[model samples]
Structure formats: structure tokens, C-alpha cells
Target chain A: MTQTSKKPAAVEALGLTKIYGSGNTEVIAMKEVSLSLARGEVVALLGPSGAGKSTFLTAIGLINPPTAGRIVIGGEAVMDGPRALVDLRAFRRRHLGFVFQKANLIPFLKAVENVAIAMEINDVSPRAARKRALELLDYLGVGDRARNLPDALSGGQQQRVAVARALANQPSLILADEPTAALDSHRGRQVMELFRQVAHEHGSAVIVVTHDHRSLDVFDRTYEMEDGELGAKHSPPAPTANSTPSA
Target chain B: MNLAAKDIRHNLGRFVLTAIGIGLLLMTVLGMSGIYRGMVDDAMVVVDRIGADLWVVQHDTRGPFAEISRVPANLEHRVRAVPGVASARSFVSHNVQREHRDEPLRMNVHGLAWPEDNGAWVTLTAGRPLGQAHYELIADASLGLALGEKLKLGKDTYTVVGIAKGMVSSGGDGLAFFTTQDALAIQVDLPGDALRLERAARVQRAVAQDLGQVQPLLLERGAGMASGIPALGPPMVSAITVRVAEGVDAAQVAATIAAWPDVSVHTRDDQEALLVRGMIDKARRQIGLFRVLLVVISTIIMALILYTLTLDKIHDIAMLKLMGARNPMIAGLILQQALLLGALGYGIAWVLGGWVFPRFPRRVLITSEDLWALAVVVAIISVFASLLGIWKAMRVEPNKVLA
Candidate 1:
């Protein structure tokens, strides 16, 4: 796949640090980590187990407040020096999306309702939320499965539904933590490709933390992590020699 | 909005089961309350039906069914002679056990003037009132006796001549009406065999008396021995019911009659208040204890059911929170489900209590107003019961989803 120049940073974090417990029992998960991602870009965060990938993702997700950091999303200074500058819950709802290892859909709800609940939490009306959810599902090529429950669909179909749910509110940034870890390689690569498509088409910056390397080519840029630090970047070879120049 | 409805639909079976359990409990509570109210109403039915303005009895006695009371029969004339007095009649009431079809039935026999001057006291539903003072009787329809049936009362057989409706004592016993003379006889008369035995024992005691032991002749010829009449006994009437004139003030008449040392007077309102006060003062504590037990049981059951439901969906609730759903929103979902269960339960209870309680052997009266009041009370209790689950749900952290 040909790559385009980064479209300008949509999310930035500096000096992010997270410590657990205190005194003799204290342990640091991440120390002075800094990173940035631009719009319409999909960045793969490759790491082994317990490599602080989850800690950094949660801190940026606004769920776990970092011990100290400066984090910015969509041109808004939401966190400065570990203190939240905005309502965390409201900000997360409006500006960020999340996909977990499991589909994590509400079991009681149908596929469409699961997608719509995100919008409803932000005070969207049911009629309008449902309409937008259907549109997103259709765009993600899972419109026919909108009426089925999460349990009734295949693993890949369920993940597609989750991706559609994350895009329902049109958030500025999407955080995916091992979203493809539960699927087989073929389905896993398919989900990664869908996330890439979502980031490009919707102009939202996407970051995926995964140990699965089979789908690494689906990402726009790949960054390796070892011992809580971003190591080196390895760009995938272009699909064809005669392909158009990188934008 | 979608979450609340979806949660309910997902667990429809469990919700229905909880509602049914609550419905059964509510039915019992409603029935008990109705039964208590019915007892009060039935107790006052006879008095209200009598429609008398005043009741005169022995001084210091509650009278009628509450206590023993007696006064001279002639007081009826004295009460009538008072200024503003319309008319007056003497009545005597006493509880007696009689045999009907070999079954012993306890009833209150009321003795009134012959030709039944107190006809207005009862409405005859069958047959006619007494024509003669001696052998005729009016019986309440509840006794299930037909006209011309003879009821044995204290060695006398009185034929039923009329059937009266709504004539019952506070004890729920049927009321039987007869002449004053017959009532006096029944009150004082003994069986022929018993009377003969008494006379024989007295003669034997006289024969055995020593001449020095107070003169045998004097013992044998006691006062009125030649006349063969027994000595006069205490005044026999149980109570005297009075109807004051249209312009008469019952309070004034009661005070004037109270001046007489041997009798007392109570207005209609006084009698009703006494009955109500008696029931409440006697049974309030017991009823309150039962009500408290019922409330406690209902709360425990509700809490258990709700807690079980919450446990079943811990993961779902965690996921919802992780998706940026506010704590209040999630709490609202649980609360809405609880309230819906309560509403369905109350509706079923109302129907069950209304349809089934009255048919009970004992009186169970449930009024519509009482039903409405209980519904509001149940709603408040339901809301309180749901609050515990809401609190538990709010304390659940979204991070628990990962765990």
C-alpha cells in the first residue's frame, strides 16, 4: 500500500508517566513516554506482553489519568500535568472511541442498538442515533447484520459491528487495544484493514496496540515498543513498483 | 431510553417471576387491611340501622353489648315526659344460646313492647311481625330459620313469625326480637324440673331445722309464702333505647337523665366513638406488629431478587460504564426495571384481593379508597427497594470490565 504524508497531528502526548502503589511496593508502568499521531493515519503499536502498551493507551483514552503528562486531542488541551482540563467522561464520549480485545457489545442489545448506545450516552435522540448507526454499519459493509445480536454473528462480523459502533459519534481519535487478538489471522487482518479504511475515510487518527504481526502491512505506519519505549519504525514495501508516488 | 427497555426484554422471565412474588405478598396485605375495615363497618351496622338518637341504661355502664346495664321499665314514660321529647320505648337485650336443628346458635334476644312499637328498628324481609306478646318472635335472616319454625330458648318454644335483615350485635351474633314479658321470663325462668328440685331442697332444709334454730314455723312461712309468687329480683332490662324529639338536643337529655343515680344516657355519636375507640385501643398493637413483619419480609425478598439480577449482569454493567455511560444513567436503568416490576405486582394484587377476599368465611372488606391509598404506599416502597440496587450498580468501576 502506498502511504501519504502525515496529515498533521490530531493527538499528542508528552512526558506520560504512570506509577502503581507506593513506597516499597511501588512499580512504574510507563516512564516519560512521548508520541504523536496525525489525522487519516493508522499507527500500529507492536509490543510483547506487559510492555506498558495498555497503560499508554488507557492514559491517552482518558480513562486512566496519568501520574503526569500533557495530552491534547483535536486541538483541545484536555490534560495538563496529570490534571484533567475538561470533563473526562464527557470529553471521552464526544472526542474518543475505543475497541477492546473482545467485541464487548452489550449482550442484550441488537447490533444496531449496540452501535446507537454510544450516541445515546451523549444525549442523542433514539431515532437519530439509530439512523446514523445504520449508516455507519452500511459504510463498514455489515448493514445486513444490523438486526442480529452480537452472539448470533461470526467473530469477524461482531468486530465489524464494534468498529461501526466506535465510529457512530464521529469521534476525533479511535483507540483499539488488541482488537484483532481474538480472531484468526485472516479475520484479524480483515479487521485491521477495516480500521485503516475507517481512519482514512473518516479522517480520524487511529492507534492499534497488537501483538499480532500478520496484519502489520494493513497499518499506514508501524512503531515497535520494547520496555515502555517506542523503538524503531519499519515501513512496509509498496504493493507495486509503478504505483503512484506517495502523497 | 434504549438500555432500560432492552435490559427488561433480555430478562423478561426473571422480571415476571419477581413481580408474581410481590403480587402475592401485596394481596395478603390488602386483604388484611380490608378485613379490619370490614369488621368496624359490620360492628356498627346494627346501630346505624336502628337510627335511634339516644340510648338510656344503668348509670356507669357502656350499655347494649359493651357492659351489663339495667333500669326500671317505667323510665320510658319519664323520658317521654321530658320537654322536646318525641316518644320513647323500653328495650332489653341479652345474649342467649338456643338450639336450632340440633345446632347450638348464640343470639341476642331483644324484648320490646307488644305489637312491636319499635317496628322501625327492623325491616321485615319475610313474614309478619308478632301478633301476640307470648308466642311470637322475629329472627334475623342470618339464622337461616323459616317462619313457623320454633326456637327453644330457656325452656320456652317461641315460634318465628318474621324475618329481619341487618339485625346483628357487635359480636356478629344474630338478633331475635320478642315481647318484654317473654324476654323477662326467659331471663329469669328455670326449667320445671330444676324449679321443683329447688322447692324440694328448701322444704327438706326447713324440716331439718331445729326449733331453736330460728323457729321452724317462721322458716316455713316466709314472706309471700301463701301467695306462691317468687321474691322480686333485680331490674331485668339490659338497656333502654330512646328516640328524642325532632327539636330535642340529645346532649341535654343525656345530662338530665344522667342526674338519676340508677341510669345513664348515651347519644348515638357517643356510642359510635366508644365502639371505634374500643377496637383501636384493643387491637392496634397487634395489627401494627403484623404490618411491620409484612414490610420486612417484602423488603428482603425484593433486595434478594434485585441483587441476584445485578450479579447476573455485572459484566454488562461494567461494559456499559466503560463505553462512557454515566453512573446515573446506568442506575436509572436498574431503577426503572424495579419500578416496572412493582407496578405489575400491585395490579395483580388488587385484582386478587378484590375478587377473592370477600368470599372468605370471616368478613373481609376492601374499599376502593383503601385500595388506591395502598397502591401509592406500595409505589413508595418499591422505589425505596430499588435504591439499594442502584447504589450497588454505581459503585461498580468500569475497569472491572477488564478483570
Candidate 2:
């Protein structure tokens, strides 16, 4: 039963450290944080303000490089410290997905086009890509707003379209930062459940940075961060004052 | 998706306003070139109308337009007698002004040595040409002269006998043709004050000789010298235009006459060059400088607009970079938008130039070849202008999206 339950890890980081500036003004944003996430698992990262949550998210997302670390994604070793082992841009496009605090949809494009362009950049055929985009939107329950621009959609609907975009390439790992911060409690909890469903249904690993404690129960595992350090696993942990909880 | 096009459509009003501003500048650039072309045409039309193979004038002078030239009217016979010289005619040209209903009308006076068949030069659109009378005149239609209207030239009245079309002078003024004899009378004939003074002096000298106040033989000699042989003021003809016979080279004949230090002879090409290059040189330079100024102004405006537009969308550019968009792709977006702006501006200028040019007092001429050449120049300019925006875009940090 234990052998059957074991799954390959999607992301692995060893001794990840991120330092900013130098000399007297220097400060460590993330400190020797080692973490691992497995396929079909959804994890939540909760932190106080300046708790290094964004630093960890960006480092693993391949945007900002870590000061010292060994990082791997989808069984491929990609980085050593700040140096990249492969072309980072191609690596990110093929293996990783990211969602920001806001939907950040391209204003000029409709929801379907916004979703499809993410695939198009990967050299996917426009017709096939658009068909897949429609399917993803339907799966995310925003198919009715496929032709509407981001400005025309509600906050939750926009986030759904953004999630559809993030999933267009079927990436092995997803990193989201405050994906439901702008939504109401009902919508935020719904978005959190959607992330949980995405991780389980696609057999993908997901890491979400959030302060919404009400939805923390939806995650498979929860980690808390403070003063640039990750705390122990929690049956439950109260959010700090620096953390902004919607409800 | 064509990101640049979608953005432009999203901001259609701002894009249109920018295009209009650039289009007006392009229109002025095109119009200046057209005006230069028109001026060249105006300068050559009179010489072309003469249809003479050679132009003979005073030594070291370009002739009627570039400098004052005085060649004797009798020289026409000698030029006609030259080998290969088919025929020759004396021509007097000058700028004159006459009053009509209290408005001063400026015109060019062409003194034609009459009794020749050169009447075929002018294409009459109304009325008949001059009779043998000295006061009869053939006028250019642009002069707005009606048939039988009287024009006062120096103390003489001329009736407009015919109207000719497009017969303007080198300076773009309307033309009037008269007999050389009549033109000499109008230009060099003594003014009323001088004529009266001369008569009074002659009367006083005659009375002195009659009263034995002076020697009669000396008086007779002086009177014979000043005799009624009609006192002449200045030479009548400004130049002589000569035609060459069939099977003869005009240059060969011009070289033959050029041997005489007292005269300078020129072939058709020499005259055209003198008028187009020498006469229109300064005007061309002025128009060329103005055109260059307009191009520079347009380039600067385009670059500024592109930079501003790029700044406004810096967030979007950063997102694209984060999504794995390459440098070429971002640069291409900026470059493509600049090119579209140039193309739209050019099209607008072409239409506007055609509609506005004719109403100008001076002639304006544009050709398709000029338009194609300008299009190439404009395309190059757009590419260079987009570089500013591309550089700004390339500097966008993909990591900015995280913050």
C-alpha cells in the first residue's frame, strides 16, 4: 500500500538561500530553505509580511535566481545556485506555470485568445491551440465568457481565465502568488478549491502563497514562513498580524 | 495574435491623432518638392516656346533672364547669314507694370521683330493676333485681359488683340507681345519732360545762330550731327534667337558665332541649363532645407510618441518577457507599429497634396516616381525611429511582475 502511494516528486530544492544587496544594507530574503513537493499534491505557503514567501515563489518560478541552491523540476536538474544548467526561458515555458496576484490578462485580447497565446508562444498551431484553450476554459467553468475581454469579466471569472492560461501547456509544476487576494470570501475559497482540484485531477504539483486561513484546510499540506524561515508542519497555525486574511 | 495592431485598435483615437500630425508634416515635404518642380517649369516655358535652336546675346551674358544683354537688331541679318543658320529674329524682353482699374498689373513685355512667321509660337485661345499697327498686342490669357481692352505702356495705348494660353515668362508673370519698333518706343523713347527739354534747347540754339550770336558753319556742323535722324535712347533688341537648318548641328553654328568676342552664343541645352540651374538654384536650396527640416521634425515626433506608448505599456511588455517572448518579438512589435504609422501618413499626404496644391498661386507638380522615392525614404525613417522604443522595451525586467 505504501509502495503504491509513492509518487515522483515534481519539484525539489536543497538549501535555497536568497540574499539582497551587500555590506551593511544586505539582508537575506530566504534562508537555506529546503523543500520538496510531489505530484498530485497541493501545498500552501503562508507567511507574514517580509516572510520570504514571494522570494521563494519567484526563485522556484525561475524569475529570480537563488543565492545558493540545487533546484530540479520534473526530474530534470535545472540550476545550481544562481547559475542555470539549461536555457532558462525555454525551461520555464516547457515545465513551469505562474499565476500572479491579479489576473494580469492582456487587455486587448479576449479570454480565449489570452489562454491560446500562452500555447502559441510554444509553437503550437493556432487552430489546435485555440481548441485546447476552449476545452480548458470549459473545464474551469468560464466557457461562457470565452469571447469577453478581461475588463468585462468579474474578478473570480478573470482569475478562472488566468488559471486556464496557466494550464494551457499542461506544465508539471504551478506556482501561484495571492491568486485569490482580490476575490470575496466565497470566491476566494472557491478559487482555492479549484487549485486543489487542478493539482489532483492533472497529477501536477501546486504551490500557492496565500494568507486566507479559512481555505487552508483545502490544501494537502501547509507550511508557514516567518523572519525568512519556514516553521514546522502544522495541524493548524494562526496567521500573523503582517499576514492579510480576507476573512 | 498581432499584438501591435490589437493595441492600436484598442487606442484608435490616439493612433489616429498621431497619424494626422505626421501626415500634415509629410504633406508639406511633398508640396515643397512639387513647388520646386513648378518653378523650374515656369522658368523654361518661355525659352521652350521660342523653338529656336540657338540663343545669341551680349558677350559673357547668359541672356534675357540671368543678365541684361543688348545685341543690335541689325545683327539678326548677320546671324541669319551664318553657315547652317536657317533664320534669326531679334527679341526684346523686359518686366513692366501697367494700371488697370487702379490695380497694378505686372507683366513681361516680349518685343518681337515683326514681318516674320514666328506668330505660330503662341496658341491663341481667343480673338485674332496683332495687325500691322504698333499698338496691337497679343497677351497671355492668364493676364485676364479681355479682347479690345486698352493697356497703357509708357504714354502709348495698346489694344489686346488676342489671348494666348500658358505663355508665361521665366518669373511666372503673364506675357504681352509687341512689335520691336513699338517696344523700343515704349522702353527707350524719351519721357515727356526730356522730350520737352530737348525741343526747348534746340529752339534756343537755332535763335542764337540766326542772330549771329555763334558761327554759322559751326552751328550747321553741330545741327547736322544732332540732325532729325531720330535721336535713339538705348539699343532696341535684348537678344537674337536663331534656328538651324535641317541636316545641321546647332552646336556647330553656335561655336562659329561664339568666335566673335562681341557676342555669346548658346545652344538649346545651354539655355535650358541656364534657366533651370542658374535661375532656380537658390529657390531649390531654400525649398530643400525646408523639406529636410520637416523630415527631422517628423522623425522626432514619431520617436517621442513611440517612447511614450512603450512606457505606458511597460507592464505588458514585462509580462510578455516573463512568458518567454524573445527580444526579436518585442522589437518587431514596436517596429511594425512605426511602419504602419509611416504608411498611413504617406497615403494621407498624397491625397492632401493633390487636393491643396492647385489652389496655390504658384504651380505645383508631383509625379509617381517622386512618391515612390519618398516612400522608400519614409520607410527607412520609420525603422530608425522605432529603435528608441525597442531599446526601452528590451530593458524591461521580466522579474518586475513578481513585485
Candidate 3:
């Protein structure tokens, strides 16, 4: 499939810093981090343990307000120097989605309910939420598993369901932390390809924090982080003859 | 909207266990409340059953049932002659013991005038009312007295002519109905030796005359030698129960009698208030204490249960928060679950209290209004209980999902 990447940047963060305590005992999780990602683009953030990759992801995802920074999402300057211009939670709900290391689906709910919960939280009616949830699941190729629970699905299927749930609200950006850490290389690569497809087709800016390098070529652009600072950026490697198309 | 149903489904075992525990506590609260109502009902049973509008007793006393009251038997005649007084009857009440199949039974003896005897307070599960005033008694079946059985009361042997049911005093003592004469005999009659001793003491007092009476005093003044015939004193009665005439205000009549120096009258409302104060006051306070304690305990248990459940799902809550779920949505979920638990607990308690309370030795009455009041009370408690969990859940940082 021919992939055209021409969308402009959807999120930009400059000099982001997070500090935990005052004078006597202070801890800094992330310091002076700058990043930007365009819409319809998928990027991979590679880092070692305790390298502030998770902190940077959370700061950009609007889950935690950076101590000092300028954050612009979907062309809106929402955060400036620790002050949020709009309702942080509401802005996040409308513009952002999140995927954790685990599927993190609500266990009591069925696969469809898991996805529908996101819509309901945003005040979507039950009928509309259910319809949208099923449509998203069908688009993600998991409509047949709508009635099953998270535990009933395989690891790969669970992560796919999680991806469907993240896209349920049609967010403009998606932040995933270790989304493919629990899957085999093939399944991890497959999930990586799905994220690429979602970012391009749905026009979302996708940033995935992963330790796996087997699916490095699946992303449009990749960046590395070491000790809370972004390293050199790299382009996707050219497609190889053995690069099998993912289903 | 709120994920309350989902939360309960997720932790069903814990939810059900907590509900059952709450149900048992609620059952206790409901039962105690019912018992309080029953006490009021029991205290009013005799008055309601007798259908009397006014009661006359000695001055400065509440009544025959609440306190000791005695008046001249002739007072009934005088009261019957009063305007708007349809009729008056004498009644005597005293606690007495009798033998039932070789086992002693404690009971309250109510003496009624012949033909003026009101029927039993409750339907007889087995026998009938006494047809004759003499040598016959209507006994509660709870007293274990069989029909046709002869029971010895102080010095008189009374045949159990009929069996009654639910004829119990407010103190839970069974009742037996007899003629006024028998009750007086049992209450006032003394042994021959005791009577002789009293006459001897009086004779000695009369013989020791004052020296100021210089003339020879007549020996007839002595107790032993009777003056022509001993003056007959009026018979004493416990109380006079009066039925007010149609269209007459019983309160007004009571006020009229209150003006008399040696007599006091009580309207139905006054008697009912006094009965409630005297018989059920302490029990009501005790039930109130139980209700307060149960509420405190239930609130604590619910708070702890909810807190634990919230703590258990901290990660899930954090993830939901990270996914942009609002504080109100999360809070609503917890509150809704608490309300559902409360409703379930109350439903179980209603059934349990209804089934088990009436079987107690004392009466227990449950009413729809009481249930409604309790439901509202439980709902308020549930809201308070959920506050802790909601606060904890809302305070959870979405960033914690990363940790």
C-alpha cells in the first residue's frame, strides 16, 4: 500500500520539566525535554529503564502537567509554564487517547463495553456509545469478539482490543507506553503496523514508547531518549524484500 | 453513565458478602424498631379493646394500670349519674400466680362486673368467654390453663370456663378475667389469725382511755364488744371506666371530674400518653441506642468495604483517569454502587425482620412508613459511606498508571 505522509505537527512540547518536592529533598523525573509530532505520523521512543521515557509520555499525554513548559496540541496552546489554559481532563478526553503496557481493559465489561466506557465518560448516550464502540471494534477487525471478556482473548487480541478502545473517541493523538512489550516479535510487529495504519488513516499523531527494536522499521520517524533528554531522530529504514505485509 | 453496575459485577463476591453483612445488621435495626412499635401497640391493646373513653381514679394518681388507684365502689353510681356519662363500670387489676398442670404461671388478674365484662382483647384460638360471673374465669391460652380446669387463686377456686388468646399485659404477662368480687377477695382478704391480731390491737388501744374522761366510759366503745352493729363502710374499687355519651367530649368530662377534691379523671389521650411513658419509655430508649449503634457500625463497615474495593482497583482507576474519565464520573460510579448495596441490604432486612420479629416473646410490629423512613435513612448513610471511596478514587493521579 502506498503511504503518503504530509500532515502537519499536532503536538509540540518545549523545555518540559517535572519536579516532585521542595528545597530540602527534591526529585526531578523529567528535565528540559522537547518533542513534537505531526498528525498522521507514528513515532517510536526508545529508552532504557528509568530513562524518563514514561515521564515524558505522561507529560505529553496531558495526564500529568509539566512543572514548566509550553504544550501545544492540535494547534491549541493548552499548557504554558505549568498552567493549563483549558480544562485538562476535558481537553485530554477530546484530543488524546492512552494505551498502557497491559491491555488495562475493565475486566467486568465485555470487549465492546470496554471500548464504550470511553465514550460514555464523555457524555455520549448509551445507544450512540455502543454503536460507535462496535463500529470501532469492527474497523479494528475484532467485531466478532465484542461479547468476549479481556481475559478470554489472546494476548495479541487483547492488545488489539486496547487499540480499538483508544480510538473509540476518535482522538487526535494517541500515547502508548510499552504497547507491544508482552507480545511475540511477530505480534509486536503486527501491532506496530496497526498503529502506523491508524495514525495515517485516522489522522492521529501517535507516539509509542517501546523497548522492542524488532519493529523499528514500522514507524515513520523514531527518536531515542537517554536520562530525560531526547537524542538524535532517525528516519524509517527502507522497506526490505522480506518485509511481509501485516493483516 | 456511571459505571456502578460494572463495578459491582467486577467485585461480585465482595459486594455480596458485604451486602449480607449489612443485611444482618439492618435486620437487627429493623427488628428493634419493630419491637418499639409493638410495645406501643401492646400498651394500647387493653384500652383499645375495652373501648373506654374515660377512666376515673383516686386523686393525684395516673390510673389503675400505671399506678395504684382505689376509690369507693359507690363512685361508679355517682359517675353514672353525671351528664354525658353513658355508663360506668368498676374494674380491678392485680398480678397473681396460679398453678397450671403443676407448673406455676404468673398472670395479671382483671376483675370485671357481671354482664359488664367486655370480651377478650384478641380472638380466642380455642375456647369461649365466661357465661357466669361466679366460679368461672376466662383465661388466656398462653397461661396453659385448659378449659374446664379448676385453678386456685387466693382462697377461691375458679373453674377455667373458657380460653382466650392474646390477652396479655404490657409487661407480657398473660391475663385471666374474673368477677370484681373474686379480685377483691384475692387482693384484700387476710387470714383469720391476722384479722384477730388486728382486732386485739384495736381493743387494747380503746381500753387505754384518756384520764380527762372522768366519767365511767362504756365498755361498748371497746373493739371486742360491738356497738349495736358495726358501721358498714363502703366497698373499695380499683378504678371506674366510663364510656362517654354520644356527641360528648371526654376531655371536658375529665376536666369536670378533675375539679373534685378526692377524685381524678383521665381522658383516653392522657391515659395513652401515660401508658407509653410508663411501659415503653425505657424500651424505646434502648431501641434508639441500638439504632444509633447499628448505624455507626454499618457506616464504618460500609466505608471500610468501599475503601478496600477502591484501593483494590487503584490501578484501574488510574488508567481510567488517564483515559480522561472525569472526577464526577468516577465518584458517581462509587456512589451508585453503594446505593445498590444499601438497597439490597435493606430488602433483605425487611424480609428477615418481618419474618423473625413477630416470633419474639414480645410483640414486634413493622409498618410501611417505618420501612420508608429506614430506606431514606439508609440512603443517607450510604452516601456518607461512599464519600471516603470517592475521595480516594478521585485523588488518584492518572500518572500513577505509569508507575
The DockQ figures for the candidates are 0.50, 0.58, 0.60
Model 3 Cα shift for residue B239 (angstroms): 1.0
Which parts of model 3 are misplaced by more than 4 Å?
Answer: A1-7, A22-24, A235-247, B81-84, B97-104, B118-125, B141-146, B188-235, B245-259
User: What tens-digit string does per-residue lDDT give for candidate 3 at A78-144?
Assistant: 8887788888888888889888788888777889998998888777898999998898888777889
> DockQ order of candidates, best first?
3, 2, 1
Positional deviation of A157 in candidate 3, in angstroms? 2.2
* Model 1 Cα lDDT, one tens digit per residue, B167-272: 7666667778888879877887777777767666666666666742566554454322323533434446766677777776778877787888888888888878
Give the runs in model 1 whose Cα sits over 4 Å from its true position.
A1-6, A224-231, A236-247, B72-78, B90-114, B117-230
List candidate 2 segments past 4 Å from native: A1-6, A235-247, B117-119, B123-133, B136-150, B159-166, B178-191, B194-234
Better candidate by lDDT, 1 or 2: 2
TM-score of chain B of each: 0.83, 0.88, 0.86
Q: What's chain A's TM-score in each predicted model?
A: 0.92, 0.92, 0.92
Task: Quote the lDDT for B373 in model 3.
Answer: 85
Q: Listing every candidate in turn, what is its Cα RMSD in Å to the true structure after a full C-alpha superposition?
A: 4.7, 4.7, 4.3
Q: Is the docking of candidate 2 incorrect, acceptable, medium or high quality?
A: medium
Per-model TM-score, in order, reads: 0.86, 0.90, 0.88
